[model samples]
Target: MLMKPLIIGQLKARLPIIQGGMGVGISRCNLAGAVALEGGIGVISTAQIGYDEEEFSRNPIEANLRAIKKHLQRAKEIAKGGIVGVNIMVATKQYAEYVKAAVEAKADVIISGAGLPINLPELVKGSVSKIAPIVSSLKATSIILKMWDRKYNTTADFLVIEGPLAGGHLGFHEDELVDIDMDAYQEEIKKIISLKKEYEEKYNQEIPVIVAGGIFDKEDVKRALLNGADGIQVGTRFVTTKECDASDAYKQAYINCKKEDIRIIKSPVGMPGRAIWNPFLEKLTKGRSEIKHCFGCLEHCNPKEVPYCITKALTNAVEGKLEEGLIFCGDNADRLKEITTVKQVMEELTV
Candidate 1:
């Protein structure tokens, strides 16, 4: 099956591909804009977005808000009218502030996850920016749909189903990740699709289901379409693209990884994350480290209690210190071989 345009609310992408938002300078204006220019939905991750700003360490919220507008403007400049969206996690400390900033900048869309985005509709109410919530199971989809129907009188513009093999923080528990049952998960995706239909009809609108996590090539795209997905969101594959915003060392980490190098570990934000087993993680396995600085990024992050600062570790990775940083990747990172361009990656995945 050939890839087709994905229609999400008022926006449409020539290719039904969304570049999943990888944070800490991974997928920023350069990467997102390049993909958008290629007729796909480009996504910028809002997790510690202002890491490069001079004042970011001193004033995180202010720097991030400023960086949001800066990055969006830069992406729009490169997109040349193509669709460019922002991926803002609901677990972010200043969630409403970030959402409002994206909407204020007139971002094409906001794909939120890391938690249920029950209040997303309300945040982008008067703006033209569309809203999408990422879910890991049928239960989460139902809850968001039900809550939106009852309280917001609206449904998601689209929904992203991130399977267990996704990068960064996963939505699944430790046990589920230990031994994933693909058949059971596929059944869950079908169930979520069924629920999407009910809400689509109830609200008299289309709620497209976009499959994410572990999506790499054309075959994966075909499988998602066959499983009832309107489109697919891809993250890890983009890490190797020349247009990706991360440093050379950061991209090299993904290239150097093997299947055994990938490990499921705990993130300071209280979620299980998949990353390459590095010296930092090896050290973490031995004992907890003292928090050097807290960016006050996540809502539940405790400065005194958490082992280490996620923002710091990720920022280190972005700066090319692989051994001391957290290297996040999808389960299929080991499957990648060489560095490629964004255009090449999109073409390979577009059937």
Candidate 2:
């Protein structure tokens, strides 16, 4: 059967896929625009988006704000009226400012996670940009719905359920990540769907639920739809696509890895993340690596404490300095066998 289109509020994508926003310059305008052009929702990650800006190190905030507009413009140019969105983590230092930037840039949607986005409606107030929150558990989903309903008198345009197998920052605990039961996790997704129905009835709006994490192939997409998700969000699979913004070496890391190479590591933001084990991470495991600079990217980061600079490590990875970088990926990153184009990947997923 052919895949169905995803409808979130007034926005509709010809494909039921939303590319997860990978950060540190991994999924910029290049990959996002390409996906949007193919009738899928393209999402630009706002995390450390200005890393390549000339004044990034000195004026990170201003640089990011400016780049948000620049990159979105480029994505729009490639999209040709297709749906383009931005992903802004709630844990960022200037979370509200980033939301404002995305809205001002005229993003069709704003997907937020890395923390509960209780105040998301307020930030996007009066804007046409739809807001979606990524969640891991039914409790988090319930909390967000209640808060948004009671405080803002609004509901999410859609919801993204990211399981523990996802890359980058996870909403689950370290212990939960290690021994995740697929059946139990699917049950959680269904519970969230049931909870969302209450709000849908109250607000008289459709709340499409998109499932993510470990959704590697067409079968995964079928399973998600059968399990009550209206769509699926994919991250690792996109990294191997030609349109990905990351360098060749970065894509090679995914192509070259075995299933055993994937491991869970501690993120500086006090969350457990799934990434490929590399020499840089191995060195940090033996001892704390020195912090070279503070990018002021995260709300919980302190220059004086924590592990190595996450921004720097991720930047190194995207730049293809594998030995000195942190390569974030989903549990199936190692399953990627070769580089492919975004159009081909989309075709395979929809097939």
Candidate 3:
């Protein structure tokens, strides 16, 4: 099948693909720009984006806020006018401030998830930046649409269905992930597409639905489009790309792992996440993972009680300290064979 153009709000991409945002210095300017330059929408993850800043340890919030615009600008520059966006998780603290910062920076789009993002439309009010809410089920979709329509008089510019196989913080509970696969989600996608038709007619606008999590290679893309999705969001497959901001050691982790290495663990951010099993996760099982200092990244995190500092673990992985930090990844991470370029990955998927 030929690849279709992905239109979110007024933005258009020649390819029906959005590279899923990987946080903690994973998908930043380099990767996002490269993908966008390739005709797919490129996305930068704003989670702990300032980990490399000089003053990040002292005041992470301010550091992160300062970095948001910086990264977006750099990514846009690299895109050379392609569609570039940022992924801001609703679970992040100072969520409103982050949204405002992205809008102020003239981001092409802002994709939010890890929570309902009920107030996303309100936050992006009057801005040209398109908004996409990430959801795993119809229930969450209904809540976001109802709240946004009733309160803000707007609907999502696009929707991302992050299935059970997604990495990092998942929308579904741990129990729900048990024995579920992509086939189980086809009917739900049909329902969501059906539900979205109402708002499309009411608002008289098209709201593209993108599928994320477990999407890899050309076959997956064909399957998603055939299943009624407008596009697909892929993360794990991009980890080993040269353009990805992750360190070489971090990228190697994706290539070295086997299927059994992948596991879902209870993340400190009050959600379940998929990650590669490593010494770091094993340490968590044997004893308490250290929380040296709070980054104040999440809205509800208590430094005293969180299993570990997510910021630190991710930072460690990004900096090549694989054994010292968590390696958050999708289930397909094990399938990675060698490091490649962003252009090559895009070609393989779209072809």
lDDT of each: 0.92, 0.93, 0.90
- Per-residue alpha-carbon lDDT of model 2 for 124-212, expressed as tens digits? 99998999999999999999999999999989999999998899989988899888898999999989999999999999999999999
- Positional deviation of residue 223's Cα in model 2 after best superposition, in angstroms: 0.7
Candidate 1 lDDT tens digits, 1-351:
567689987788999999999999999999999999999999999999999999999999999999999999999999999999999999999999999999999999999999999899999999999898999998888899899989988888999999998999999999999999989999999999998898888888888889898888788899999888899999999999899999999989889999999999999989999999999999997888778778989999888888888998999999999878999999999998889999999889987
lDDT score of residue 202 within candidate 3? 92
Model 3: runs farther than 4 Å from truth?
Answer: none
Task: Report RMSD for candidate 1.
Answer: 0.8
After superposing candidate 2 on the true structure, give the runs of residues whose Cα lies further than 4 Å from its correct spot.
none
* Candidate 1 minimal-lDDT segment of 10 residues: 1-10
Give the runs in model 1 whose Cα sits over 4 Å from its true position. none
Q: Write the per-residue lDDT of candidate 3 for residues 107-226, one digit (tens) a residue.
A: 899999988798888888888899989988888899889898999888989999989888888988788877786666788888899999999999999999999988877888888888
lDDT minimum window of 10 residues, candidate 3:
177-186
Instruction: Give model 1's TM-score versus the native structure.
Output: 0.99
Which ranking of candidates, highest lDDT first? 2, 1, 3
Error of 3 at 68 (Å): 0.8
